[model samples]
Target chain A: MRQETSRAQAPIPAVAGIGLRFPHHRAVREDRPAIGWLEVHPENYLGGGAAIACLEAVRRDYPVSLHGVGLSLGSVDGLDPRHLDRLAALVSRIEPGLVSEHVSFSTAGGTYLADLLPLPMTEEALETVCRNVEVMQTRLRRQVLVENPSSYVRYVASTIPEWEFMAAVATRTGCGILCDVNNICVSAANHGFDAYHYLAALPAAAVGELHVAGHALRELGGGRQIRIDDHGSAVSAEVWALLAAAVARFGRRPTLVEWDNAIPALDVLLAEAAQADTILSRERDHAQAA
Target chain B: MPKLRDLQAGFAEVVLAGRFDALAPYLPADAIPPEDRLAIYRNTARAVMTEALRLTFPAVERLVGRDFFAMAAARFVRQAPPDTADLAEYGVALPDFLAHLPEAAPIPYLADVARFEWALHQAATAEDAPSLDADALGAVAAEDQPMITFIPHPSVRLLELATPADAVADAVLAGDDRAMAAIDLAAGPRRLVLHRGATGVCAEQCDADAFAFARALFAGATLAGLVDAAPAAAGTLLAGHLASGRIAGYALQTQTGEP
Candidate 1:
């Protein structure tokens, strides 16, 4: 039996937040950036050392969200018991406002590949993903949001559209959707789908969070190119436009600006989050006027 | 349609094993060749796993240079893919993997340098534990002191390397070319004890006897056993370790009447 602590769970505001990576930990701690909130990958903190110690300190002033990249929620083998237990322990300790994992698997044949692999979006994959999401929710004893992945490949066997698959997971498992607007733009560009239609397919009420990140456009020969969700730069103007449309549809959600690689200074990340906050604020006013 | 399990297995083959044909039947052809799309996944997987290794073994990366490190890391990733998702727990086998690689033969000390860096990585993330209580030891009678056993802190790691791996790591990390040149490659068997405290991770070199004693204590040896194993400086070294919070807690064993 799990013992629930009396620590008050901080609710994440419908504003912009920054993905707290290792480089910005000192600045965030010492200078105490006036961001709306903070988000981090729980896997980094589970080992319990200086990283967790830093997260614990930062968690004091901000409403943190655990955005898991390694849960393999779409695995056919089901959720990894140890991973779930560790995540549950972290949730109990941190009492995060929102917990989320991708709508993709990172492990197969008992080997963790360490990158979010795309699912085929077939009925079988949907069943597997929904089952795993339910197991995750049961173990954590809370609703978790599932984020859409940026994919370069699509399978012929995929009967369901990607957005429909995301919606099915939320509907079947009673989970929330973490609409990564940047992923929608990237995947739509890669597979030739409308990013707005992808957003429209999702249940607006189920969208509890949004992620906006930068991507790299890699060029192939013959003027062909692919959008890579590298999350290593500023949010693109196309993604910002798609995010604006998503905000208009979903009204307001906890949007996060994620920059994982080639991370710039703290001010750059804050500026990205501020950009998101501006969109979120604009949407809130639009809703009020309507 | 193939079963989800089969689909995933085929997908893994495509991404990890580089067997693009394994999933060719499932992927619909378009302007982009199937191999090109699959290459994206393959590249990303290799890149992310390599990045994880680079994080844990920066000294090794620095020693071998980035290109060589990436080549070795890619091979290691395929050979011993992480069984768990917590990437911090990943790449435990890279040191041994590097040791056996043919290309790594030229740099004999590279493996040991990796081993040292891994120890430092482990020390940074190991679980926190309280230091041994001094008053509790005081409560024990003098005669029972020898029977006392220690509980080592989770952050403590004892390493005995055949090369001066610590010096190599320090020089490489500090980017001190002169210090790197000054080190003698023939130095044998550096014993170190690494632990995390209030400030950060610390690695300290010790003599043979002190290393033996600390290893024994970490292995759940009774004070009597530790002294018997390394009798020269058992008392002095034990006090120093306790003072430094290397011992998390301790237990006193009582002799059975039959024994």
Candidate 2:
């Protein structure tokens, strides 16, 4: 039964949302947090059973967004329709505020790497991504958001810049951009590019959501730090500062506090989300004061 | 002149086949040393995928120890990278891979044990649907029984094994290593009916009649047809299936395509 009111709520209103992981399911169900929204990995609920049942309960109170890490959107072998179909089914089930996938490819030929593998920022890659996004949107019957991936390696054949590639995908496919501040920080440090330049190059209006996460910095051989976006710890001060800047510029977007590995207690995750909500509030105040 | 496909292929090779020497030249120097960066991916791919195998094949891991299991898991991941993103489905091929592995030849039963565990993992995630009522079968007349296909509950799985796979899994789950060690060839060829009840996935030794009824239902055999084609112990089979939730709901095959 459709709600008689045709006026539906907007995609999480530029506030701090937390990533709803498996461990936190019970807690989230018991105590509904006063957070902006929630994000979940679509692949986790592919077949549907208890986990899907849990998520169905969570969806009633919160605006849910689907973030896909395993779609392998940039794979050269073309998009996997089976995965797309499952994703479409999930989207239909939850009616998530937004659906997003990484710009990285996780598989090649027929095998899945299961990691967020980087893609060369070439014209061919861009065309493949755009076409895939178009197909995905058509199948889902909704606009999708494309996120930039953190990388430890870059391709020599890549002529286009990461920001340019992201902007082009959004522009060509009519998709939205899910700008991840941690990815920008990691990619910038890895590739020796300016993070701000990458952010500035983005088509601002196309960005529908933002992602903020923690990273692990490993000391390399020559005093260089290899920062991996592990998302295991609390949001670092540096990433938080960058997010503040983003909110100031983009006027606040639905942001996610993603901690996949070494997930902390539900209270800890909620605290982190509260901190992000504070930043969003500060930005809103600044806009109002202006 | 590398196309998108060429780059993707090379990237996969570097990660899966350890062909990093070819991809090293293509990586930028500002990042970590190409090989070290590649090692991050390799270690990650190994760890994430190995964890799935460990979950499905805990008995195998217990038999070989953690260190050996990790090494075997890395090898399995390299051979059979997951076809889907669902991590639960990633380790389905580990048993097959173990069966053919030169190192695993000595422990021939290891593969079958892993297969049994994987089936349990699959059953845990299978979709749940209401089972057909046995009383509903009485309504169907004898003439129309041929078209009657009894749909088994989604939770029920028919596993026929020549080895004591069920006993091994039961012992492992019960934390009885001695029971696993005491298994002898004399105790061979057992069948198990695995189903998800109100509590969780319950595994039990199904009698011949019960097994036949479940299989017949899975094959879309109706009650009337099942009675004619079933073994002489058909009554006992229906009783056992009904006692458990294995026959949750059933429908006419002509009415519904599959259970």
Candidate 3:
């Protein structure tokens, strides 16, 4: 058994950072880009190898955050113990600034679907998510933030709004909320809701981090389209505006510019981070004025 | 409204089996038909699994064209979806899956290439450990040398393949069609040992006797047993592995009643 105080935790700063992917591992390790921090999917570094060794080297210079893509926090079958153990071991090894997983479930009936499947906004789901979050926190011996997912379809059984369900998870579990601004934009456009209202509903105190990413618009003909959260291209104008709104509502947080597919060069990601910093700075100036 | 577990099961059915009826009742009515909306999630799930396989088995994808690879990957995903979140561990069954696939039978060497690639993937991602100290081995009493059992590095893998898949994989990865064409499909079984060192993953072919010796040593055979298994090259092979740092550590086997 490992003690909670065995490793010291690094706190993420309230500034823009980049999501570190495999392609840029060499560049980031050798060049050591002048960025605020770096976040990675803990799943990638769970198994030791060149990947973990590289992460160890990079962690020396930057405050790394483990953003998990497959914890399946909302699954009714319960969390996978092996996966949790691997993640806990990684946390002990990395001692990241922050650790997080999605509000959706990817495993069902003993099969991992590989995509973040949406959960019905029902009381049962709320309970399941809270229970899973508590389990994760207990195993990891630390607080974990749950990020809201982007969805194209809504369930008829959903009673509570998406934002309320998210806020409830934080309130019930004492965990933080990682507000993905682009997901808010994509889900709002797909479901015909106000993104600003979604942002305002989140508990200010529970908001610990923010994410902004690119999404694709898929047309269904006849002047109708669904915004897919593919994170393929540049952040759209609408998402940038929504991110600005989130910053204003949540204040400056450790925001990340996420680009998973069609990732560009290191300079391009840094440019996106710089763009987010501009909005974050404006919020700081506004707070000073207030 | 279905229970949360039932809802997830139904959603998974829709995503994995394309059975929209299971989830149709839960979806709210929309301008886009419910099935079409559900397809978005389905497509993303398939794409994610496909991409995971592509990352691990790029040579397999190159051996088969993109469209064919995608089709095969989709089939494999549906048949054997991953049970864990760590994708690095996914796709372990693909080589066997392809070996039995009728379409892939035309390319008889494809499965072997995939097996070799999986070995490469495992070697690259296996845990890191300290190599054996050469000086420590010399200090052991000469009498105990025969009882010394060598421990192989965590990343070492020994494979006896029926085809010359390594050369084909090399050619395919390099996109040298001429080199790929020159490979003799009739080449007999080849024995290989793969290990990761300070530089990167390395694979080498060895003679049958040496292969058996290394395999036994890795399987925890004492020096005496290793020599019994392959008397011709046990000493030379052990020395070579020690020099290459393949042996991580060693232990002496005590007498039966000794503590």
Candidates' TM-scores? 0.95, 0.92, 0.96
Which has the higher lDDT value, candidate number 1 or candidate number 3?
3
lDDT tens digits, residues B38-124, model 3?
899899899889998999999999989999999999899889999999999998899999999999999999999999999999988
Candidate with better DockQ, 1 vs 2: 1
Q: How well is candidate 3 docked (DockQ)?
A: 0.82
DockQ of each: 0.77, 0.63, 0.82
Lowest summed lDDT across 10 adjacent residues in model 2 chain B is found at: B248-257
Query: Which residue pairs overlap in candidate 2's backbone?
Result: A14-A253, B131-B248, B131-B249, B132-B248, B132-B249, B132-B250, B149-B220
**Residue lDDT tens for model 1, B51-89:** 989999999999888999999988888788888888898
Q: Cα lDDT for residue B75, model 3?
A: 90
Cα error of candidate 1 at position B14, Å:
2.3
Which is the better candidate, 2 or 3, if ranked by DockQ?
A: 3
Off by over 4 Å in 3: A1-9, B139-141, B257-259
Candidate 3 lDDT over A3-55, as tens digits, reads 55432237899999999999999999999988899999999988767999989
True contacts kept of 1: 0.80
> Which one wins on DockQ?
3
lDDT against the true structure, each candidate: 0.90, 0.81, 0.92
Q: For model 3, give the interface RMSD.
A: 0.9
